[model samples]
Target: MSQKKTVYIGPFIQCKTLTDLDICPNGMIGVDEGGRIAFVLRDERGRKIPEGDGWEDAKIVRIQDHGFFFPGFIDTHIHAPQYPNAGIFGKSTLLDWLNTYTFPLESSFADLATASRIYNRVVARTLSHGTTTACYYATVHVPATNLLADICQTRGQRAFVGRVCMHEMSPEYYRDESVETALRDSKACIEHVRKIDPEFDLVTPIITPRFALSCNTESLAALGKLHRELDLPAQTHISENPRECDLVRDLFPESKSYADVYESAGLLTPKMILAHAIHLTEEETALIRARDAKISHCPASNTALTSGRAKVRKMLNAGLNLGLGTDVSGGYTSSILAEAREAVFVSRHVAMDEGDEAKLSVEEALYLATRGGAKVVGLEDRIGGFEVGKMWDAQMIGLEAVGPETTELDQSAGPVEVFGKETWDDLVAKWVYTGDDRSTTAVWVGGRLVHAKEGFRL
Candidate 1:
């Protein structure tokens, strides 16, 4: 396939701000040969195409009335190795779930063949669901973790692949031997990703400490220091469950609080991505905002594991950067759309306890999936939404129509039903409430057709 300059004309929808969505019913976006948006033409009734040097030969793709262009999803935190174990957590919370399900499955990556099989499926599945960029947690095995980076590069999904680091408090068979060995293996994986994608354009390495309970003081400090030395993004869990919080308190008695454990180790930097801040104190929230660190709200995982609902409305009001995460296995679903739905539900639950101001609207949840996620992964300038100079990471969503005459073939489009009398807002609301991966007819990353449904072609 030729990576030529192309023009996409269609009804496009994207979050213009945290509370508002920019729905361009008729728009055109020009993508250059390098896959960046070169020009954008907003709603202009029957306007003629402007002829210029490169615009003269641009291929044009027009979206049908039933479809619209949307920014691809970004999963800020997910365990790629635990994909197979998704939905298997039975009546277990964070700590017990790790021992019963997570550890045993992650330890199986010692076999290179097994790692390749699982990693391949994970990348393909996420892309199929329109996850253009993902922050992945690979197992501690260096070779397996490196294999994940290689697979993402080959498959053309933008990703941050991290080799998990845990030098203490983990199962004896799966844990890293020592602080030196953990650092060495982590460096090896980082170097491997750098070699494969030298500029770190598509795939980058992230420092992952697992969590406070998984690592000792020495390992946490060493990883934090390495994070600064390499200037890489870091991700870890914090304040997910009451038991996990109690364990961190017991483990780091010298620290004032759970957040202080990471703060004292120098891990609370702007590039840090702390997942599941469900039980953060006012002091911790202030500290996180001061450091400019981001949060990944894994709503589905939290509910499934019986973790407390994160005060998302509070976090947004505090000027904290936040995004959605699947937290697979614990989350039970890899779809960010599902996470967006869960986010809305979780916010409603918060509202029931703390009043109406705590509720999150659909616009806010979708924002967390795209723009917010881009910021969390440190790629805000590159892949969030449709704008000149941004990469063309987008999905084509098609909804089924239910009118006087409806065919079975039309119903195959998905669960969302449009009845011609609906406005653009109604259509989008229907999508949010009832849509699934089946509604995603086509997906693109960097102007490349990464996934397409059977009847859809670009």
Candidate 2:
């Protein structure tokens, strides 16, 4: 349980809806010992709010000048073990990139030492980037995957850890030996997560079939069976590349389309999170929406690998719940803010081809980062925004203000520059377009201080 009863005071920002941001110029929020928000109040005069049942010793954390508290990012899909190979996929698409850079690096996770080194850095790195919650795909090794669960639990970041299952089409050295071994090892990893977080309060287990081509028909069916029996959340890759989609046709001829392969295996459900649906047909789209499965758009990874642009606006219009994912090494960067920027850029490109309706405004992209992400992870009521009962999973964003306090040598304040004339929306747009990790000064998960950069204080 969290021991901190913290009172945070300052400006706050959140998605009021799909097209607008809820910006409170002066606000205060009280977090109780259990990490749930005890209350949220606002006043023009910045007056103090009433203290709750707890007698008056709550610690106070205030946002700095020109800063605001925004909901922490949720990365709905990422490969934890592939973090080492980030930005190394040079001139290769998904298939060849997997063969050359991804598999070889992921295979090294068989050594617990490598898993420890990389997992530690990846967790810290993502936390620094203001990712308070992540859905991670660890390597096939049970011990290594379990270590990842332990790291997230100990670090206080909300996570869903999955053991990657690729029974065939993968290299011999890294692939699961058989369908039985795949199920067994995946179960072992799930049990490990249970042991670490009994109620899955901070970390849970997800059944991850690497992709359709990597797993045979029997393995996918068996894994789906296990999913139903355990009632667990599932994740997998979908139609990411044109050639990969065509290959799925030849491999699973009986299935109607790429989405049908998982449907036939009973893996398409509300609890499933399918990443990179850049090439889904209308039938496949309707099927996924009917099933209520979520989508994690990875624009950076899609563009980095020269994958086709994902029609995010089209998906939203279909009434599908959508979220953003860094996709880590596959997409290159681990920062979700950068991924949000990529989403806007990719949407503009789509608008160029289609029409202006395809362009996603800054508000829409940020909504996908926070609120839409919460819906995708099935935690809409818990962590998406500031409310009377939501958990305090948030980040403090600071932009340098130009004034008498500014000096020529103060370059450490980060990439965003603000004059006295910009509105709140303009400031947010600047951060979305140009800001990086340096602007994410502090991060919190469930009222606990998970990450705080240098010079940040409570």
Tens-digit lDDT string for candidate 1 (194-270): 89999998899999999998898888999999999999999999999999999898989999888899999999999
The C-alpha local distance difference test score for the whole of candidate 1 amounts to: 0.92
lDDT of 2 by residue, 1-458 (tens): 85768888888999989999999988888888988998888753547657557627888888887889999999999999999888988999989999999999999998999999999999999999999999999989999999999999999999999999997778989899999999999999999888878899999999999999999899999999998899999999999999899999999999999999999999999999999999999999999999999999999999999989999999999988999999989888999999999999999999999999999999999999999999998889998899889999999999888886766857567889888899999999999999999999899999889999898878
lDDT of 2 at 386: 92
The window of 10 residues in a row where model 2 has the poorest summed lDDT is: 43-52
TM-score for candidate 2: 0.98
lDDT of each: 0.92, 0.92
Prediction RMSDs, each to the true structure: 1.4, 1.1
Q: Single out the weakest 10-residue window by summed lDDT for candidate 1.
A: 404-413
